[model samples]
Target chain A: MRSLAILDSTLREGEQFIKTFFTLEQRVMIVRLLDRLGVTFIEVPSPVSSPETREAIEAICALNLRSHVVAHVRCVEADVQAALDTGVYGLNLFFGTSNELRSYSHGRKIEQIAHDAVPLIRRIREAGRYVRFSAEDAFRSDLVDLLTVFDAVVDAGVERIGLPDTVGIATPRQVDRLVSLIANRYPNVGIEFHGHNDTGCAIANTISAFEAGADCLDVTVMGIGERNGIASLSGIISQLYIHYPDLLAAYDLTQLVELDQYVADCLNINIPYNMPITAPSAFTHRAGVHTKAVLRNPHAYEILNPTDFGVVRHVDVGSRFTGRYAVGHRAVSLGLQLTSEEIAQLTQALKERAERGSLNDEEVNTFILAWYEEKGSLVWER
Target chain B: MRSLAILDSTLREGEQFIKTFFTLEQRVMIVRLLDRLGVTFIEVPSPVSSPETREAIEAICALNLRSHVVAHVRCVEADVQAALDTGVYGLNLFFGTSNELRSYSHGRKIEQIAHDAVPLIRRIREAGRYVRFSAEDAFRSDLVDLLTVFDAVVDAGVERIGLPDTVGIATPRQVDRLVSLIANRYPNVGIEFHGHNDTGCAIANTISAFEAGADCLDVTVMGIGERNGIASLSGIISQLYIHYPDLLAAYDLTQLVELDQYVADCLNINIPYNMPITAPSAFTHRAGVHTKAVLRNPHAYEILNPTDFGVVRHVDVGSRFTGRYAVGHRAVSLGLQLTSEEIAQLTQALKERAERGSLNDEEVNTFILAWYEEKGSLVWER
Candidate 1:
């Protein structure tokens, strides 16, 4: 279970997020952050596309971060050469294998694909570099065709294989079954799983893959990638830390929010409100009943403690849904003591104001202080 | 499998979204939209919180939509009376049963809670209104404690029992086990599931509950709730439509996008980029390799068709990753024929330009026409 390694592909797959264009400086910063965060591998764009892409890869590699840098390239010979020229630690070679891709993408049959990959695999290995041969749409590809390619690549000296749910078509059950099949067949080889979130199952599918014995999982920060992105790094961490802490022992868990903030700022996209642990409201208790309970004991309503990720808990006390208990707690915190009746009245006043919209802390405090004065509670001071 | 019912809590749970303050008119509009979308039940805020909450409930009930309107209230008699006064078709009574909530929230032990709920259940039943007794933190409650409370409520004439993963602490396996246990024990009772998305498993857990024989599942538009929201209505729909289309045949599936857009606009929040099926990027395919295959067969990259949801597919063709095939296809569509070598050169130029950032359609067309003219491609006219 602890064998799973993280391959942070934020620089590679995240570049595919709609309208995302990371500068060379942004790429270096992201790679440095991810490396310091202790991901095992950092997958970056290949040099095949442009001179700047190659420069970005070369700059990342030159940083000599703790993480091993890898490049994602197609199976074409020119791509392989460009990857080698980057002086990276490893190369991930991918090809379209599903029937739809086979018939239309490269227009290559299974035999032709397998035959073409052997020499590339041999060349990458001969250069004393790490290599992984991946089938682009492994889940949609025929099982026989996938195995044939896997077996051929292994014979040609490749030891790692990637199974990608390229179209995000896989369910968790399917992910588990496919991963277990690959694990059993390639007992000596490492299996990697890459999934997309088209149906909102990417995180679950990645979990299922790990549970079924995949050794590596692909993730992008905030799950940013093409078409709704892939499994999010923080989301995976949130799920695993609670159930499988040992797998993440090497990572600095507290830096999760910092990473999310940095990436969101760099990309100029707001951290989504529903982001698992780092969203502003992830730890906010708003409903009257929930605020009341969470005020009494955070455990009453919270399972993921905000403190674990360097975030503070916020109990909203200025809404129509704000309960008397939350208001009373706020009153006490502000150095005031109110009777039960006063507390109820204050809560009612706040709720009415909130019915029109939300109120800030200052307004809530003002209402409480005015209520105290109106009730003669501040008569001694006057 | 088709026994599952949708209890859309957009008005009830969605109100807990941070800063959400739906006016009476907004609440009525949302209720109308949901009713038109064909949810079996529409759950709304209880009247006990404020006069306006009750007014909102009354206004929705007055609409008399085809779906039943249920008010969510505490098990307290005053709350029950407030819900009853609203003239809602049903009442949902909830009590926190977990040790954390029992001690910190209501300070009632199992027997005390059971003793208190009997009269409220009896009163609701005597009023001839549909009533559901729910355990607020059912997932965290001791199994015996949960069964004890559930049994007491059933004995008190409550026909429906809700199992809420209140803190979002449940896994898929746990949801299945808990649902199966209650399902087997109380075959005559209705089982409803309300899950949260803290660990990003709300939809998965809800689906697991359904698979384990739950009769109903609670959802909010965009999964908006207190903290990271609940299971999204669209996420659940995306999962079910693929596996249980018969269950959702009654719904106007095309209205899903409209509903999401309306709610997002009302709340002034962007629909998250990863929102299942409705996000702008949900059907947008980028990546040169992906565009090529998607052009051949959309199924190669898309499992859910955009047409089904009144959306169109967008093939991103102006990125650094643009392939020659995608560019050449665009050239042909624009009535220009270029040699393979020229297409490759043009693709390279586009990639180089894209390294600075993304290009608009006009920019791409300008580059293509310039290249055609530069290559002296007026041969057809000559």
Candidate 2:
């Protein structure tokens, strides 16, 4: 496992979804947050889009952060020049290469695309900036043609080559095989994998690409990007930390939820309640079987403690799945105690309320206290 | 392309996320909606879980629809008995088979699992119910052992074998290769792919599995299930409909957004505004360039028209990217004729308001009308 490399694309892809375009100051704050979170790269906007976008990129570039700032651009001379004008540390030059794009969308020959991309990549590198030449639809492109395009860009002095499943079509095995095949053939070429969530395979494909010898991963905060979006930065970071701890350095994982919420607020979008890691319910337990185990040892049901990410654990008593153990634990936390028989009676009442789908935490506590009173074992003064 | 067989797990998996558990009535409504939408299978809950669940499954089984009502059950004789008592049209028999599950969770040997599964499968077959055998964590299990477990279940009269990436570890290529390998070797056995969204590969893996000859694809409404959830029913349906229209038939695609919203409301979960297809912004354009193309031809920026999914195309004039095309389109819609200069002026005002992040639809229209009045274009008599 290699140390995880987080590339924050909030400015580039996340801005695409905002009803209101971000100002220079807002872009500066986002870059600061990315820096605070110790992200490896902060992807700014395509400088060719607008003067405002270019200003925002320049503002981000002015920030004194350890993280590198990169600008996205189409694989053309003007776009490359626009990106260069922002003074970004690195450049991501992308273009459509698949048949769907070449024949149906761009109506350009594959050779023409290579010709347009290679010289621009050489110019960017000659200017002393890092360059990652990307094939926009590499997954759907012919293997021979993809190799030829990458070879041309790499020979033209591009430091890295990125293969993007621009349409979210590639599978993990295909990523692994393609990345490995390319890496093996071109020993000096650095590889980066850019994936999308159109088919929800982004993260899996990214990891497989890493295993296949890719040096870096392209990700976005909350997976905000085109269509169904890309692999989530938080999801990938947490997984890498937990499963491949040896390969990656420690990230400011505790800041993840806060970062997500900030972005959500900025974009005026609601993060789904069940979104992994950041979701309110992700750490909560209500099922009877799960609750029992969780009450015994939270590790039984939780992959990691909620507090690890500075989130609170919620004991939800909203259904028949809510167990006696959870109820008893909550009562104990409230400094109450009950005998076995009283606890069992309280459990039965709770179950009945839950069965009706109307149970709440207060109701469950009320029933527990009433049971304790009836059994003459009430520990509270009241 | 093969016709995609959608196995809707709304009842079995979707119910897991709700704080307010579904009543028998709500379950029936969901089943009816799914049936009307022409899903191939509707997975009802385990009868052993509750009397209400059993009642719901029985009621759905009695419905006169093309969809088969399949009851999900643990691979145990008692669970099978409960399922049989409900008279469900089909059985989804599932069990854990990975070393982690066998050693740490269930403490059962692989041989014991095969032994236990075989008799239950045979009994279900003897009872004349269509049985789908699933090896939980099949993705992590050794290939030989997994094959052994699947072979035994298949030979014991199981109608289909479900290969689940229980931990969401399989890539699309892995899914394709595994399913194709199984299909090639076990020509008589039907293959079903059950995927999770842990690493967010569920949809791609499902499609790959389909291409690899899998007979059924397991999905949940809004992708609700354990952890990060399962493959999204709406997403899979839309992908199949758009990309492989000849593969399936009779689905009322327009009902998709309505059905998804209905389920989200019942589950008390807010649908993310960025959710594909059903999201508010999915068809709404704020970018100047996109709005221009949309005004001339909506298909220029979108593959499927909004009306096709029971949604209206919205031109949101609340971004620096909002241009004259959006203003002109709105003016035309309101039966107003404005000069190019007036449209440009209004567009500039909208962009300014958008820059401040305070723009609204009414304000945009107000500004446009005011601009028309100033230019002597307003005809109040009409």
Candidate 3:
């Protein structure tokens, strides 16, 4: 009953951001990497954009990856036709519907917009391809309009419906209510959630969507996309793996970090050190008290061992919380041992040094060994 | 009325995650920086932890900072005594009550835990100091229990209550629901939202909490703290300044990027290029189409002008997307001009070079100028 599906939109949405353009070969290489990583779906470019997009899509279709290759298309006949020409495995048709978008940006009435979406869904479905219709800006759209569009698309034979916080404005409560409403009203259709990071809520909204019974999720590698970008693949996958491990069974959890690093390198972006599970600091410890507790029992601070994702727990002594265990461990590494009293004195000395912001490994070891020598309990190896 | 209140816990929660020990002077320096940055409150260390904390808190209090200094204390009698002894401006008392915490960690009855939080709130209130009672695992707590605990605290005269996603698990929907529930129930009380990034929903949760009527937010520079850390100050501030400018009137939006860079350097951590507002790539363009559009109109792809944050747009041409605009701009910058048709030809040649991943600025400019010269369009200056 559980499935792990990775829907990658690097070529379509990721290309939209930054000035780094990908050629047919680079695009093909990105797809190849996703396939090698065993992603469930690779979202290729919109074929309507340019001839280059058409060529990129056709080249990817030729790869015959075990993973499905989907094409992103606007909710218009012309765009859907372009997608069909690319021969993608599925079609992800999207359009805007928020008040600001409907009334100001697109200058279209909600009723007219909903009507426009239905035919596009039908056209894609009639082509015998799986269709996922997205209500762009759903977070800001009126509930009545959202539900009406969802109902229309479902009736039009859309296999899946995606609700996007195009401007990253939806909170988790809204996501819960909306997803729950759709799950209740359209039990036969798959529900997906696509989010932006305009307000940095992409991950939160996506998770809320899942809790409310979303069957699919949209994510970008390293969160590379427009504006603040989309929900990061690592962020969503780690959360699911940690809190809802039973929800996704096919993913190789161990390869998660590797896959993220690979994609980050390909994108030529440095991963944020505080980035959820992949950052170096994610598992490293430096404070004295926390390190002592960790030495006694790692569960004191570590929820999951960093090694689970191929990372190691690093204990640094340069912080204000340097603990006894970290100090003792450093002493051991330096080939020195002393009585508990001597160790206590060394700890106090190290604390003072840390307070002055002048503490270094060499200085710490020198102080520790000196204390041991003064106590007449020193044991030093060559 | 709108207010901008910053709650800084660099010495408390932030110190908890530091791998290196900081001196008392360094602690004071950070507090001074906070005061300089016009932070509303600074959360000092737990006095019960060690002599250094007590001394640092006492010293910081004596400095009489414009920003109020507070002590973080656990929901216990001894901890409260320790905090009171430090003579801080406020107390932040916290405890856990979620199923995961109560059953798996605390091993205490929920009722007993809830009762413990009330007395602590009363104790801080009776002492005539400001108080913020945080539900440590509020995100995962049952709605009934969460509401009951908040009601008890409010009835006991607690002024502010913080709803924390202690393990970084809540989505935006959950954040909005919790904030709305508390705001609606305790109309007069202050509600704060504290989020973690274990699930990468911290920023979104903070914004949702604001929309749901939370009065204050908890953030850290570079999102540094325990585990996946908390919501980033820069990310939240930039989003607010851009989309909800009216919500934070007193905050100096122009100082945001500079402040972020300063914090990163002080912490000795390099800012990630993809970090929301302050990232290098945040305003850099490298693709052909985007560069062309930007050259014609920066607003074509950019939502906000980079100069608003004291940054400028840069167009790099290393990737396959490097188009005619990049080439033409370079040619113009080199004091060379070609006919429109000749520029188109050179653009095509540059695109081919970019696709081959070997385009250099010198070589590209040389090829364009040579073609222009042969066509009698320009003469070489040197």
Candidate 4:
């Protein structure tokens, strides 16, 4: 697990997100953030895409970052030549293999694709750049075609091969089986997983690929890419932290939240509230049962420790569904002392008031204080 | 596979999301949406949580919606009694079986829990309401203790046994094995999966459980829950649509986007950008390679058809990553007549201009037209 590496594609695949247009400077900043997080590779757009993209790749490469700067390029001559000119650390060359892509998108024969990638792979390697060949839509491609292309590319000096769920149709089991078969076939070669989120299994698929012996995985900030995007940087990190914490020791986990925030801001998109580890409410606890359990031990309901990521836990005691335990905990934190019976009574009264309308934080505290004075006196009279 | 059931917990677990405070009217509207979407079960917060929750459950029950209204309740006397009083269709009874939860959260031994749930299960069944016994944090609970509690509840006529990854720590393979083991043990009993997204494996776990013979799955509108949330309703639907399209024919797929939006609005949270079928950009395409393929045939890169969800495909042609094919597609769609060579020149010029700043839709069209007139004449002269 510790040998597994990450390729953060926020600069390359992320540029395909509907709203993303990372200015050259922003691209540089993103690379810096990726380097700080200790990602093994930072994939940028192919220089052939545009003049600024070429400049951005050069600028990022010039930064002398620890992470390898890889450029995503087509196997076409112009794209390969442009990538070589950029003098990046690596080149990720891709060609469509699925029948849908072959017949309609690229119109290339299987033999043509298998033979064409050899020289491009050799060219990148000869230029002192690491090379990876991805059979685009590999999940949907013919097994024979995929194996043929892999045989040619591996024979040519490609260091890694990408298994992309280009259409996001593969199930976790399918991904596991496929990646294991391929990883076993080429044990010495690196296998990378690039999954799309169309079916909402990107994180799971990535995990399956890794568990199946794929050494490299592709991720983007907020999973931002074409359509619904791919596996997310924060998402995979949280998953790895849960399953393989030792593997993430080199990563600056604290920088994840800021990195997610920066990309979301740059793209003018919201950090989705369901985004693991980095959402504004990711560490906030609500609901009576959950809040009560969390009050006793945050571990009762939470697996991800907030403090580990430079955040804190917030138990929302103002909800109508809040428990007496949570309410009482809040009261005690505010320096109020109440018996169990008194706490129950106040909690019931608060829920009744909250039924009509929600109470703010100050109101919850004010009500607790006011009830302590009014309801406490009434209880004594009783 | 159409026999598979969906338990939408947006009203129940979603309430635990820190930002969610669904008003009574909003809760009713959400229930209506779920009913219209044809989910088998609509799980709502237990009445014991708050006075308003009791009223909301009753109000939803009064609608006589086609979907079963299930109340998520603790397997305690007060909670069970409150759930029965609400006259909902079913009760999803749960108790902590894990050591941490047993000692700290609820303080119930395994035997006590095993014994206590039988009576509540019998009583709920006696009240003409369906009952489900969910061993909370079942992933962490001892297998023997789970079997014991589940044996008692199953004997007492519980309709379903929920295998909740309550702490979100189970891997997909772990979930699959556990679900298979339990499903094999209780051949007649129904199995449900309630997973949290803390590890970002909720959707995959649910899929694994479903694959391993679990008939029911727990999901929220936006995967919103205590921590980072759970499997998303849209996510499961999208996955099923891909793997088992016949199972989703009964579903009103078009309502998916609206349901997600309605819930996000109620909670004042943004819909996750990677939310499979509901996010604003879920159907948008921007990558040059992707757009080119999609323009030739949407199926080339898209698994989920936009028309199926009442959304249109948006091809973004303003990015520097725009390919000549994409620009040409845009030109043809805009009724501009240009040869391939002219389109290539215009694409090159567009990329050069977009390098400085991204162009808007109108600007992109204007640039294409200007280049076609200015540079097209030059091409003819050459």
Candidate 5:
């Protein structure tokens, strides 16, 4: 089993969501909830970005939550000083190292970037705060440049060296190879992985990173961040809970759905129906074969228990895709002694009705009751 | 590069969505669009499930589109006959193989399952149609059971053998190992992979399976199947586009968003904001630093170009996360000659207002114009 820690950037990364705007109160609420939920770290936006940002960071730091409050800042003196003023327990200093970002973002050469980042790393370490120096587009940067820059910060006493797939371009294989390369090179330093979801591989890439020996992963609530956002907190948790349940023993697993709900409600966005554990359909069994097997034994078709997440499994027996077995099960559960033939007939009728459109729960019940009392004789009965 | 084929099960699996009930016309429309989108195969529910299902399958087969029509059936002679009657070009036969599913689902031993499946595979092959025998819950099944059943069917002339992570329990490494085991065992038989999204590792697992020599992958549009559906059509495309753009050359990539919208609309669900390529936020850059760099060069922060999916990149400059560079860029685009210092001040003010709540485009313009006129701005004075 791989050791892992969670760092939630719902405040810092989520603030970059197009619809997200965290008030000072909202920031405190989010941080408090995340801390209570057992997130290892809660990252807030750089204090240098705005006065409100600085104040929010300061207030969150003052709350003295069990979770470490991390200030995500740029690799510059002013940003470093601002973060220092926030009294954050940790600092995440980043600079774009990819050629595209180098030319258009800070316009700094590799040597200059390393030279500039080292002092901030030293300053943050001197202040007795855990510090991480990140290459913002590590996946796209020249490998040699990433090694040189990461080495400089590590030598400057940074505890963690960060690799971010800022563009969400890294595949699982690529993430594995890159993290393996870096992890092998810096055996003593902690590795942090920050990935975006541009290619829908953020969660997988994060898992790959951990498998390759990264210690911490950066994620955001509901995956809300710039562009398609970063790895989602719930997504990462769901993956771990399914494949490596022991690693998630420290987390309050039941709070995952509510956490997603809270963030989605705050953002005024609907959770996608396919979102790992929180989506409505995540545990809904509707297909005939699946419904049949799941009814008998949920483990037949479910990898995770919805009850574990404070969610219920819904079996849509009213859908046209439902089978005789499911209909039979539902009828028996409703105290009806329908035979297999009757169940098949009723299932056929319900399926035809479903072909036109969906039937409500009441409608399904009405159909079942009506069929039970109706005068029509089946071919077998005749 | 790996050889791959797409098997879309939107009609079959999507019908299992609690809210999804596609009419014959709707099914036909979906099949046509998928065919046009270069899907290699379209799998529909077995004809044994409902009359409408059979008719839909027949209609799709009659269209003679580029995509082959497949009937997803149970491992029973009756289901095989029903599927054969539908005129589908291919048949996907599945039965539970795991101890959990064996004891609870069909109450069949490995011998009974293999005995029942071999005849069906032979029968389907005799019909001169493509046949695939899948071991449901393959990941959880005892390896010997899977090998015995798969080998029996292969000997019985099944054209393809399927490995389904029925509960989405397999990790990428597990998937790779399993697929490699099967691929190595049956050197002549084609391998198919069907994965569920219960753990959000379906797409990555699919990629891993392909990397391990699986030839065909099962996907559904919007991933709307039972229990959070299967691997999403667009998600897989996004992964391939990111890591193997050459493989997606045959696909009508630009139609991905429309495909997602069509499915989501039909299901009456909002596309989750974090959906890979089609969600509204997929291309919306909100972080000030990201917006600044994205404006200069989109590749600086994006791995996949929005235009490739007929989508546009939106740089949100009014959000609190917006940086000085973004404010200056926006102001310059608006023909305002603000100095860097003034831009910084205005950005800070805007971020504060944003912290209170979001600012509309008009409000943002008003703030900028008012600040320009009322302040003793250095640029204006000059």
Candidate 6:
């Protein structure tokens, strides 16, 4: 089977998230954590951005962590030298190729971009470090322009070709086709995908790249990066766990919780409630149909096993539409005994009361206890 | 061009979210708002689920809104009658076909499922209402079994066929292939896609199905539903605005901010920062490279136009990574005159001070004003 390698960019792309500003210590801590998380690589911003940035990269490289440390740098000589000086395992060199970025961000023709990138790639390779040459805003770049750069960089001994959907505008179908085209052209070179989530397709686009033979995928914690960010490590891994479990054999998937928590704490934002696998409701079953089926067998509703991710499934039976099975389960869990008839009646009562809104466990238990009180001197237990 | 329709499932699937419990009036208001937003259909829970659910459906129907109202119901006759009784414009009937659900949720043979569904679908059609037959957990269902049931339902005159990625296991490629297969088999039937975000592919899968000839796409306000929810309305629309503007021409896209805010308020959760379109950070540019380019041309980095969604782009220059151009722009806006040299020096000082954390505008300005004080009695123009 082909490999699906992760290059976590929490320190590089993630630092670009508006709310994030990683300290030197925080950057080191993140690199160490990512190393333990078994990411194939840990990407950091180029050292030239600031003194602390340079120091952080140097400290990270000195850690001798398992994950390779790569610095994302512009296709400029000074930037390349600064990154090389930091002793990163490699450098991710990029030049914007999209007409908009070319006109506004960097005034460079597509032809000239590859020429500039080639010497840098060759120098980095001669320095005994890996290098990836990315045509930034690649999805919008002319296909021929992209291929021309890839050819030049590959010939210059670049180890990987990075295709970034800088604007996050590429559809999964579009990304799949493009990655497949590039993968076919450069069968030996690692193809890395860095997709933004502006369209909420980062995870899908990353998976499409993988399925289409792209070997390396870039991700951040909570998909944190510029604008809507890129694919989250947890989101990507969760989908992989569902369809390609073998790909994650080296991963201690449970540690994702700590990683996610650390990043969320750093940003001072709660993990999005709708985040896959790591969100508050990723494993919570509340709808009657879901709650009933899940109670019968969790597989009936859950694709990702919560326990495997160091999270637990919560079957909330206090909702208006929750079925009698969930209500009975709730009653039993609350140390209340009731006949099937009583459970049905209690379920009806709770459903009606929940019309205004759902009840909490305490409210549900109180109602169940009240119903049970009429039946007998029910002994309440914790 | 083929028509792409929307079926907003906020009332039906969104209410199933653990934190959501729409009161009768709130449900009515949401329905009215969605209708004004120009969604083609509004899906509500089966009227038989709760008294308020039924009342809300009746109230919505009586409003004479342009959007079609549909109720999601089980394949049972009583559920169909309950939906029909609510005067809904259509009924969405579903039965589990996945092995896990077949064995645990509902112990029905594949043969029996269609046999039971066809008669109910026929009855709903005879009632002169639109009828949709959804194969629940379509992704995991045996293809032959799903096709067999689809054949029976289509033969029974079903207006639409829903392929729900129940438990959110389907990849975009898989959904595309499956939706294409079904769409080709029944060319006249409207194909609906209802994908869950358990693995963060919901938005991509929904768009994939649409691209693959699925006519109807289901979306919630924030993709809120059971578990991690489904595709968000704003997320789907943002991607469409970027790549398939024609598909969304019939809708008022700017109103998405209100829709997202309403749902977030109802759920008592913040709009996720990574959410596209309506998210607070969606248009906030902070990275120096991004801020510089965006100030030069917003399109350089942004795919979705913020103003199109009634949101403004914010170029924050207070952070360490912000470029000198942003600082200069801030200086200009703050009515401070600084030469290029002065701006660069101030930029350096600010970058050094911001290593501990990003400074607010106030803090950045304090340093800016202090630098100005040293230069001269520079009449700071606001």
Q: Which candidate is the best by DockQ?
A: 6
> What is each candidate's DockQ, to 2 decimals?
0.73, 0.24, 0.25, 0.74, 0.70, 0.77
In angstroms, how far off is A281's CA in candidate 5?
1.6
Per-residue lDDT, model 2, residue B222, is 82
Runs with alpha carbons beyond 4 Å of true place in candidate 4: A356-363, A373-382, B360-363, B366-382
Error of 1 at B205 (Å): 1.5
Per residue, candidate 5 scores C-alpha lDDT tens digits across A1-382 of 6667799999988878878877778778888788877998899888877777788788998899999998888887888888888778988889999899999888999999989988878888888999988998998899999988988888899888899988888878899999999999999889999988777778888989999989999999878888778888878888888768898888788878877888888887777776788887788888777778888888888878888888998888787776788888878877899877788788988888887777766788888888886735443476
User: By summed lDDT, which 10 consecutive residues of candidate 1 chain A come out lowest?
Assistant: A373-382
* Candidate 4 per-residue lDDT over residues B337-364, each given as its tens digit: 8888878887888887877767878998
Evaluation by lDDT, superior candidate among 5 and 6: 6
Which lDDT tens digits does candidate 6 get at residues B1-382? Answer: 7888889999888888888988777788788778878999999889889777788788889999999998899998888988888788999998999898898888999999988998898888888999999999999999999999999999999999999998899888898899989989999899999999999899999999998999899999988898889999988888788778887878887678888888788778899877888888898888787888999999999988887888988887777687898889888888988899988988888788888788877877887888778656654532
> If you assessed candidate 5 against the hidden native complex, which CAPRI class would it receive?
medium
* lDDT of the candidates, in the order given: 0.87, 0.73, 0.72, 0.87, 0.84, 0.87
User: What TM-score against the true chain A does chain A of each candidate get?
Assistant: 0.96, 0.92, 0.87, 0.96, 0.95, 0.95
Fnat computed for model 4: 0.82
Identify the superior model by lDDT, candidate 2 or candidate 5.
5
Candidate 6 CAPRI assessment class: medium
> What is the C-alpha lDDT profile of model 5 across B85-117, one tens digit per residue?
777898999988999899878899999998998
